[model samples]
Target: MKKKRSNAWLYFFGALGGVLYGYDTGVISGAILYMKEELGLNAFTEGLVVSSILIGAIFGSGLSGRLTDRFGRRKAIMSAAVLFCIGGLGTALAPSTEYMVAFRIVLGLAVGCSTTIVPLYLSELAPKESRGALSSLNQLMITIGILLSYLINYAFSDAGAWRWMLGLALVPSIGLLIGIFFMPESPRWLLSKGKEEQARAVLSRMRGEKRVEEEAEEIKEAERQEQGGLKELLEPWVRPALIAGLGLAFLQQFIGTNTIIYYAPKTFTNVGFENSAAILGTVGIGTINVLMTLVAIRFIDRIGRKPLLLFGNAGMVISLIVLSLTNIFFGDTIEAAWTTVICLGVFIVVFAVSWGPIVWVMLPELFPLRVRGIGTGVSTLMLHTGNLIVTLSFPILLEKIGISSLFLCYAAIGIAAFLFVFFKVTETKGKSLEEIEQDLKDKHRGSLKTETRTAEQ
Candidate 1:
């Protein structure tokens, strides 16, 4: 008899961790520039400081699967919220280079957990018909967080207030912690724990009383499968999804999106812009990032995942090629500066609409309920690995090869990513998670029978 609650609160607070993820990652792009002088950091240490989070993320994601599975999704998120506060405050107050990198690694742990869990959490809560759009809220929040960080960076750049830029992340961390307590636990998690009555209550509150029985039954049926763990991930039926999820995760980073998110200011300065002008240019890119993600959120459910991936990949390859040409031909001229900004803008627009949102949406959908947490963890682990490699190598590569060669290399990677999506990725629109899992099993079974017939002949 409790009044039905709106799912908006569920989506917002549930995905709020993404804001912290975006802010922490995006703030570093600007903060590192100022802090480099104050902390006496060179390129080697600078890459270490920026990429240290990825190392922590690697471990955090690996651990989060078991943590969320054992403790439940809400508590896992709550734990990450706590880490965000500790890491943000510690990083801001650090005095030495060692202290800063250590604290950033701590922040990375929280980022890793949030990135892996938020999309999974949202996808499990959303109905299959609207799951793509609903889960994309996590990506949308991430873009907002990035834009917020850029704004903070521009505000603080003149004064070189890097500490303030890093510290402001604490504001949203606290908000997420407070809001999570009021939010319902993912009903699927409850069902897995054998609390069917409690699960139904949560479903009723979120989906109204009528839809609870059928959806709860479906989840229950899915759970009846052998409980999944890391071992089950390698089983023939699950391997395809694992390969696709990990592949997308890898390509998503290596295609060079985070280079823009993490090093746009540095990139702009390399072309010709001044410190403040470079930071301002990143703000423009961040704005385009947020706006275009809104476009993805609108069309993702309608257009399906593969098409977005295909279109976005092609656009990225073209933009990066153009960006490389402009930097090579124009060097430090005014024309190069404008062209650099324009190319990056177009790249962000395309990436925001495709890989940016779609990767997160598809990762959770790719796994079955039994292994969803761990599978997503493994996928995100790959994601953070790619991010670490690219983030760490970019500054070094830029110095050694110049921006033109580095970007051109990324464009070639983009072409490879486009081919991977065309050949390997599958459309997941308008399908339930259970349905997707069944389809995987069906295909695996079909392939095995074909091999049997060939052997008999």
Candidate 2:
């Protein structure tokens, strides 16, 4: 018999997919500053270049669902790995603005698919009891990627070595490709394809054979009811699921956290810090992000999702308020600079442990088995759309309205996100996908009755 595989080995490498996605996204954060100088880009042009990847991401996310369904999840990830490799090489070699934009789009496509699929893939592989924490490994890897990129930026920032920053993403991309080779295909996906024995075989590697059999049976029953198409997603019950998933997706982007991730170095320079200080400051924020995400991974299955959302979003509102005040009242003083950093640091930690990781965990669980992939893809499409708008508009907004006003807008959006979570987002911790779906169906039934009564009145 083949040696029983431990999930530890699988998770380490499978999570590398997230690492590549994170590195690609994070590399541009600091590299964009240098790219602007080398390319002679204005604020508008810079926004255009940065936003271009998001456009690809929107489409990539939309397409990844079908790709995974038709080709299998493992193959889909392999395809993304190819894109990451090519995108990294092309981006590093680009000689002009148009080439860079196009290359970044390539990376965006890869990043989009990784972001959408890794958590889903991981969740599908993990047992229900440990699903929350295992899925969070994707987010943890993302923070790691971000921190790695910040370190790379700082290392190269002195010589304006933007190419190296972008090129280095190639390392993880190649590593991810090699690592996926050792992975077993997701048992859930295998079962869906009618390869029951193959699915069982895969599951056996992850757990005891009897447990694998029971779980396979459970997944089969859940999937039996999931025969759905696009229109199925619009059914009264299904619509609520879509709203909950997509709302968080859009709100995650609109909260403007990416503004810090993408433009922190430049933003700090504009505010008051020297180039070295700004880079160091950005790295500092990245450090907080990784550490807090680690803390989150420890407690996610233990603490529950709603509490994290409530706690984090509430703190975000406060942090953004403080950040805005510091910028407006204190201007460019060293004290204000430190204050800005502290507030952002808090926001980073809060979000790292909450919305950042939790949203990815929630997306896959929000839909029924039949439409889960498409539903997730559609939600991710909206997310990238929001990201596009925010990324594209940040520079223009900062120039036209200033940073204080931009952050104020984010603070207001935070209030709306917090309320949405309190009312709409249900806790899914420690629940299997089947259990979550049944609960959704029950809520849908009650909601339908209430609507019928209100309509009669």
TM-scores of the models, in the order given: 0.98, 0.96
User: Considering every candidate listed, which one attains the maximal TM-score?
Assistant: 1
For candidate 1, write residues 167-270 as lDDT tens digits: 99999999998998987888999999999998999888777889999999889999997568888998988999999999999999999999999999999888
Q: How close is candidate 2 to the true structure, as a TM-score?
A: 0.96
Candidate 1 has a TM-score of 0.98
The local lDDT score (0 to 100) that residue 159 gets in candidate 1 is 95
Q: Would you list the C-alpha lDDT of every candidate in the order shown?
A: 0.92, 0.87
Error of 2 at 322 (Å): 0.8
Clashing pairs in 1: none
The local lDDT score (0 to 100) that residue 258 gets in candidate 2 is 90
lDDT assessment of candidate 2: 0.87
Q: Top lDDT: which candidate number? A: 1
